[model samples]
Target: MSQFKPRRPATGAAIAVLAIALTACGGPGGSQDEGAATLTFGVQAPPNSLDPAQLHDGTQRYVWGSLYDTLIYSDNEGELQPAAAESWEYSEDARTLTLRLRDDMTFSDGDPVTSEAVRVTLERTRDTAGPQQNNLGAIESVDTPDEHTVVLNLSEPDPNLLVALAFGSGVIGDPDTIDDESTALNPVGSGPYVLNREETVDGSTYVLERRDDHWNADAYPFETVTVRAIQDRTALFNALLTGELDAGTVDETQAGQVERAGFTLQRVDGISVGQIVIADRAGEVVPALADVRVRQAINLAFDRQGIIDAIFLGLGQPTTQIFNTLSPAFVEELNGEYEYAPDRARELLAEAGYPDGFTLTMPANLFVQQVQPTITQALADIGITVEWEPVPAQQSGQTTNWGMYFNLGAVAPPSRTVALYFEESGSQNPFGTTDPELDGLLEDLAAETDPEAANGIYREINAFAVENAWSAPIFLQSTNWATRDGVEYVGTANALFDIRVFALSR
Candidate 1:
């Protein structure tokens, strides 16, 4: 999901903590009977559609995660775990993956969760032109030899394939109604919870009733799960303070106040990397950006630490590399390669035959307004003039005249991150800048089967990208979650917010 700025309170002191009775047995509706348990979660937005194939990462996972069971599960630390499929083995060439499913599992509609269901779900997801379609592009076909055995035949070796399955690509839907238009609003899956249609209000509140027949029901602690969409951050914070929400995401600026109000704060660091993407590295738009020294000068122009302190409230780590800290490709030395040196930056600009610097055009949107002034001033100091073009958030991607723009890239495994941002076909590589050395390294990484060998190639790619100044990386973004008393949540390193990580403190 693209990063967007959330609305914050006008002033920190403007919010008042209201004393509302916190119930021990129920949700936002106050107290309930002895055996009833509920979890009311506040999300920034509601799911655009309930179809698993159409779902994207981030907030959408708050609902789809509980409603469907993925073939594999990713833990808090990003380790692969078994979910719908009890066991899986990769072929010697790493081109085929065999899965063994639990025969006892059944969907909410009482249909058996067989190998055919997995085949149909994967095929449907691959066929649909959705955000997750790219995740399954390597699959040549799916084979189901029996009711419980499913095998995936790949066209080539995919190092990130397993990790992809642990996310949206892995979500299994009911084959019977997955294609029906009604299934977009009403979903059917073999999951821990069943959507309560009577209590659900589309686009506002969704109530998911626990399914007793689900084999993995014990993993989810709440009997009833209510996901509410509160777009305004201030209102969501108020809901947490007033005991209307058991858990919700809060900005770093509100972390102190949230803790003082008796809510437990959980943070996952390095979920994303905020950077200035120099899209026209080939200098197709701006001639100066084509110079290696010019690109390096741009990297050294900004004071990343200062921006992190002022804009992020000191909740991030300054870095010059795009790879997340947890990734195997991350190199500690590269973080300090491009120190804040305005004099050196100016020297580099002069050496590149642009002593007066050049004018750069970039798209401006509400999502990037918070850091626009700082970026403009930083480039101005190094002799570059920035011309801002007011563009709607929806139209930001369509406008391609920009030489550079602020972006928050999702952190994932090295291979997946490379595929999504660095490769020619990458979503983030809008300009399609290609280097022969980088291309060869990426091809080697893709074909390598051994974990150690693949990671070594990733490190080489990381270093090469940094040396070339692929982007002026600022810092790693942190995602925070706040929970009321009696509730506990463990955040994941990824950008997704999975409800399964939540549980009762007791």
Candidate 2:
């Protein structure tokens, strides 16, 4: 293994100071004991609204997930599972999906969760013009035949409908209160928890009381779940160490220190990877990146393994494909061809008519900052230089399509991941690097229904993407969750904390 020490030791010192400063503030939870009946969780993202339809970000999804139940859910293996809907079946043409809602389900306000409610909730979601409305664009219409039966009519044969529903679009809100703007702050749903409006702080802390009358009450162990917004990594670590939080997500680099501090750490293989999105592939902003050879050279320039070992502290796996290993579209064979080779990278640069190299600017984030040094040195070795343009994490979305942006997000199926970038109207593709060949492949993949044939076609797309070096696939990130001993919890491949399954020590 190649050794590389980071140039910034100040970051390390800041973390140490924050950890020590927490002790001076006194132990966390003055009245809330360590092993109390209530479970307090430290969340990095806070919910902007309680309404599920209005939510778009992962943090909001977690909070909304607690406040509402979805029609369907995905198991650890990514298979569709039932939630509010007891059973579902697809038509032979794959254009229609029928669902059977449970008769026992009821919203916190005592209103029955019926098929009509499903129609209304979904229709309202589309009409609201919120962030999640686009996810439901495939559904042409929703039909409610009876009190417990819902049938969805599709505009086209979309295989990703179930997966999208199993995610944010599937969350069911109470039809009675969904239209009210107050619902954004005080939500009522057929879920395990009800918001304790008196104790809950709008942006800082959210306290939820368990509903014993919920349909799946037996599955939820915590009587009360408290989600606190602690965006700062240092604050999260301090909270975990001082007993302010019973369970909280941690950065992988800090996992060992958290465990050494007497907290139990659980790691899950994430469906997300860290990558650098070269949005300006058309050379609109950076003239040199337009050449495919320059792009390939950029891919070959990074010493992935060395950065993984030194910068990530051996917590990450190097990758060449953007899709997670578990994704059906991910081609294992394609991952090996693009190993780090500086000499070959230099050759590619020379072949692209940039023997002297060229400089480009990229947006910086925490992850970018960590790997920037290695990237700087590796590119310099290949006669290339990069200038990082600083962008705050919260404001990073504005930087997309500007030049290049750091993309560290969860990987879904091909339809949501790979095809999402290549499709003509794809949301993720804003730079407009249009290729007739790539566009045709994406269209074919979308229309194909056979799993075997689809996977084969996807393999071609994956290989082509790697050969072109569309983006620099860094690694499949390992997410860490810290909990006190005796807390029974399991991390998920999807990276969502299913607090309904969490149980305290008896």
Candidate 3:
């Protein structure tokens, strides 16, 4: 998952609430599981391919944990806790870090998690030249001094490294586990859960059983887990209602219905926003969406509240900025005042010379379809008629052409979230235009060791995004689903799709 921005006053509070909520879930002394438990996991959409190193997704992140453990972890409370390494010390200069390893841990194949293995795994991640690479950007070098120890030499300090490790790409695996085929296709991991079996027929699905000798047996919550690729929400809801699915992905509109049907709605929290990005493709002057008035007009025209009521089913709240509703960064003061403004929208439209109206094309994949109708109505109100079509997902690991395209992205991290989606070459910045100042902001924040300093930059860029109207926000959606009654599951912040925390009570 990517990060979010802190533009609105309410963002600070949301991040605080999320941080507090995170603490109640996991920690050094974990809560005791009542007893033996088995869980069934459900995935809305099956992975295009199960390669963890490819593109990190929520489902993929959870699945990676099922098979592997990371050297470090960003626990539910957003703190770096030990996974492979028990404790670590950073140099006073903040350039180097030394880690103490766990001696008892072993791979499923009975191989010990040797210090050499830790060094090698990290080496692979840093090998930009390697097939499975990424997430080790901070560290300039890695080495192992002793059997129970590893050292990382960083070019700069990175407090977010632990959180970064929490990503699917950061999970540590046995060096020998890498098969000639895709590591994600079927990779061996050192996690508390192990793959029990794979019954591939229609679409691929895998079953995971808890390891009896799990390294963190004291913290292991569930005995078994399963993931289902159910993309259709209505079908998923029906399955939940009929006891077929443990739970399913839900729109905010359906939240009340689920509660009424005797189900608990575990708030699906993520930094994703339903922003309609007006990309400024680098070539043309008005490139993709260079007209600031045009961007503002689109924002003004979209009846965000209407979408909340119609598509999200009244449970969704309208947001003016791109920060997640759950972040402490989104405090009360920053909560935006830019409610839906129609006349202003029309005026902005005229300013952009699309006075009468403009035809806008909206993309709809299974995910986008959830809000399609509401978006259509919102655009119509501002003289912008929308043409809805399901844009086929890109075949390569690439995004669709940057333009006035309809799409949804999860800006998961609030601190420097947009940078990954904007600045870097060949990164997710779909608009294609590059700004040196914006890239500089990203660089400062990425390398800033101090949270307060990094936050200042975050505020700066978020304000810039809003003022420049670089992006138009729709709704901040969650990336989770649920089972029917009788399933004991916690909607984990750290692990989005972790069925490992689920257990059937009845």
Compare the candidates by lDDT and give the number of the best one: 1
Better of 1 and 2 by lDDT: 1
Mind giving the per-residue lDDT tens digits that candidate 3 earns over 1-506?
A: 12222223336677566434433343211322434444444555565544444535455455656677776665454445567777777677667878778888888778888888777667666664322343466678878888888888988665445555555545566777653364656566678877665543223456667787867654554565556666666777776666555556666656677777776667755436677666653424233256777777777766677776766565555665676655534533433545678899888878777788766455566656666676677778888777765554422112444355554554445532453445443234544566777777777865676677776777776766676676677676654455555564554443334444553433
* lDDT scores of the candidates, listed in order: 0.80, 0.72, 0.60
From the highest TM-score down, the ranking of the candidates is 1, 2, 3
* Inter-residue clash pairs, candidate 1: none
Q: For residues 1-506, could you state the per-residue lDDT of candidate 2 as single tens digits?
A: 11112233246677556434432332222233332356788876577677767765454565677778888876656666678887787777777888888899999998989998889888877666655666677788999999999999988766567776777678788887887888899988888889899999987899988787987765555667889987777898889888778888787667878788877777766546777666667888787878888888878877777887777666667898877777777777887877888899889888989988987776776446656777778778898777777764433332333566667766666665653455443444556567878877866766787778988777788887888877778787766778775454564665344564355533
Per residue, candidate 1 scores C-alpha lDDT tens digits across 317-340 of 898988888888999999989999
lDDT order of candidates, best first? 1, 2, 3
Per-candidate TM-score against the hidden true structure: 0.84, 0.82, 0.79
The clash count of every prediction, one per candidate, is: 0, 0, 48
Residue pairs in steric clash, candidate 2?
none
- Tell me, what's the RMSD of every candidate? 8.8, 10.8, 7.9
